[model samples]
Target: MKHALNNPYITRNFNPNNWMSDIPIIDSLSLAELVLPGAHNAGVDKKASYTALGISHWAACQNNSFYYQLTHGARALDLRLEYAVGGDGVGTFWFQHNGFRSSRSLESLIMSVIRFLDENPDEFIILDFHQLNPGNQRFDYKEFNRLLLTHLGNRLIPSTHVFLTLGQLKQASHARRVMVAAENHTELDSTYFCEYIEHEWSGIGTASVSELNVHITKVMKFPPGGSLPWSLSATSYNVAEGPVNIREHLDRWFDPALSDWVLNSNIINADFFETSNLVRHCRTANLIKANNH
Candidate 1:
């Protein structure tokens, strides 16, 4: 199962809690794969199946009523494929899959989006990377910067900014700021780069962004703890004017539906897959932010 993950940066054994336990933890990657019923599946009569399909479709649609209600009438989703590699492969996109069920669940959503981008390789999508944590003496900024430049740079169209959450970055680093790495490290200072979105895209010989009808997601939130969201910052591509204090507000921010995120023991974490009520709140908050913008 681990071999199936094609990501070079993340492998099976990338464990941060090695000292505490010996069990291998799966990477928190969003890979796309789904279990759609096959035509050969047992129990259904083919003649009746096709005849009843139209009614089934409507029934199913009605069953998933939350989709229309939540999206405010926007049914079909638009994906903004942001490629990660130069061959026009890895990237992110935005789509409206109705709700967080089946294919739209977080894991399935990630997988489907990537699959769409992978299959449509010629359409050089936009690309960008953001630092997940605050850059301080604590992180290996130099190495991460190098990796970004080598792997993800030049591929991401210009003016596509990467977000770095410096909410906890204090100027002083009296403690040791050792950036340990099993494989990679990078850092960049005073780095600001931009170019025409197409200049870099043309290198891949793909369809124009306009032709693809790619609609960018106005807001992308990478809440701390990487779950539904315990703490939220303006993690969008755009930065704000004043300072944002994530710790103070997010430390104990509570909602009851969050219990669904609880993982089993050291095996999982609170809001691990982000299914709890907290996720709903976060998505709502994100929509609000998008509207405000």
Candidate 2:
């Protein structure tokens, strides 16, 4: 009598502990070849008193803390910040979503990430510091670099060389690597602060998911190897709608079209990533690509 073959999908239970651990097959592939799940406005998890009504419409993009975001398989983080200075000449940083200030400080967020990376050695992260809100004074890129280095320490992957693959990063002396990309630090010597890879972000003007789908579809079409390592914003925000609940929107529309978006973009970023199992979808896309290769 012939015995039945075992199916890995049936035998291996889907582990929620770390979705990144599930995609070991793509470890040897270039970062450009993998599809990473990302969070848009990753820092704004809470609302502040000074947060304006219009800004509040899209303010709390994420509902959980930074640590939670990592655990849920978000590899890329979009951070917008403003330099905060005390009367004593000491300076700190605060997260900004549009013009509204986040209740949590930037240092707090960085510390949380450092602690997470220390525990999870095999995992790597991409930190995109995009927007800066300088009130009256000029934004200090040098000071920001100092703070980033102090917190990140040796965990940062030097911009001097490109990290081609996940396995390359895992085998390095410092297993936990973070690629930092900032908008202001343009000079080549600023290794820790580099520019972002191509990212196509759709405007948050669509009031309904149907309207938003059109924008998403248009952005997904790209020439072969056009925008390798590119990010696509899959979430939607309408200032006129007032306080758009991300969780509700994801369940209603984004979740349905997620698989197609994942196939098209290297990074598919959304609001409240944990809600609709967006990370798992991205992982599946990577798995499919690896199998085909």
Candidate 3:
């Protein structure tokens, strides 16, 4: 019951979906203290139809679905929303990457997050809405607000509650477990959602594994300080690179860094998260930190 069939990518015999809930010690850690695995471009996945679009190789960062990412232990999701015209002549939000809108709607992905949270109540998640691009000059903030309030309701932790430990947040919400971080917002109130938490990236824009490794080393030596939580984007972008090629390089860098590099950041965001043992390492880190405390 704790595992799925053996897979070459995902680690076997672990409860990723309920990881936070399963580890009681994790509840004592604040969002700023715990190390978590995050999915970069969390909603972009490869399907046969998307592959036919010819951009799948470059566009897709994930080989699995959004729900699969959550189930596999991605606690933070980097989501970009695009307002696109649907077949019915109405505009709706879709998960987007590099100007390519996905076939999946943003609402569907949110619902899947809700479903996962409901099933595993103690597990918490951070939804980082980093960008909201509109197709036209005017975008409907009202509709977007309605979508969030209608679907997420009270499950969203208020922006003011960012400082709370997971146990404190759970008690504050009577057990609600999600924080919606929308950086650009007009109508949505801060009481229900927060701005995008700060994050740091290589700034090299496109980097090879060696370059990224150097960047991380420099940052950790002089990491920024603040009460707010931040993430380290452990990713490199290259249009010529596909998931497999990028992962092959990342695997070489990640395994060694898990024990040391992970200790420096609250969250470690990556592309193709399932292909590594990040979940296990993160859990181990949390346990050690808690025990030491």
Candidate 4:
């Protein structure tokens, strides 16, 4: 059976090269008013770790590089960082998912985002550092923050100003600004670290499509007049029978779920983000909101 996500029109209309071109006024909308396409485990690729069960079961969430994800209209990134130890007793930062190391280092991922922002100055991104995993070694939060500031430089949007609308953000600065949310790092300056953003739900661990849909709809309910920006995750975390084929799960649920909840969602994060019309859908939702106002 063919999946809705396989439609040729989706590919043609939402091509990465010009995805943002359609939404010229996107920067002017409030963050909550815009429905941003997000990537879950945004850094995970073919290089992620797996159990003896093989890569099929523990396959990575994303197929393309970070550069590709950004160019394709993924504005929000779910990042997990860890301290990696080498044989020389030296530790470096790495991107990890469930303790599995990604092929790309943390430094490389940050550089990719920096490069993207350098080229596309009008586009802004929400970088959610959702987790910091320390594997067998003690992790230094301060050091990690230092590394982030060193690479990101002046591109970061001051934390105090992140709650504003896209237009307000653009008006505030000429350089592109990225909203950085370092989870559990409340001690950092408010100008760079925002602790109020909420992740409504994550990881629907089911293989049954019907059951998954039920769970997705149930968690998607958000209260009216909420202040913080929240995300509704449309990706599955585990499959009961085999390796996690997130693409298959997305093909089955992405369209239906978006139809039901896109209007209310702040961000719709999924796996294999480039394979579907997620960007178009988000833009449409934003347009609908704009019209209602």
Candidate that would win on TM-score = 3
Question: Roughly what TM-score does model 3 have, to 2 decimal places?
Answer: 0.88
Q: What digit string (tens of lDDT, one per residue) describes model 1 on residues 193-231?
A: 321111111122222333211211111121123211111
TM-score result, candidate 1: 0.21
**Whole-model lDDT for model 4 versus the true structure?**
0.67
- Compare candidates 3 and 4 on TM-score and give the better one: 3
lDDT of residue 43 for candidate 1: 12
The whole-model lDDT of each prediction reads 0.21, 0.65, 0.73, 0.67
lDDT, candidate 4, 173-271, per-residue tens: 877468878776644556687774567653445434465567676775643335456777676655543224455545444443335466667777777
TM-score-superior candidate, 1 or 3 = 3
TM-score of 4: 0.83
Clashes of 4: 2
TM-scores of all candidate predictions against the true structure = 0.21, 0.83, 0.88, 0.83
Which residue ranges in model 2 land beyond 4 Å of their true spot? 1-17, 47-58, 184-189, 204-207, 223-228, 240-259
Candidate with better TM-score, 1 vs 2: 2
- Candidate 3: tens digits of C-alpha lDDT, residues 1-293: 01222323234356888887777876778887888888888877785134136887777777778788899899998888877665677888777777766666777787888888878878888888877888542556778778988888778887788788888998888656787887656687778777677778888767767778788888888776565668787887774765433555444443423335655667777888878777776776676556555
Model 1 alpha-carbon drift over 4 Å, by segment: 1-142, 155-189, 192-273
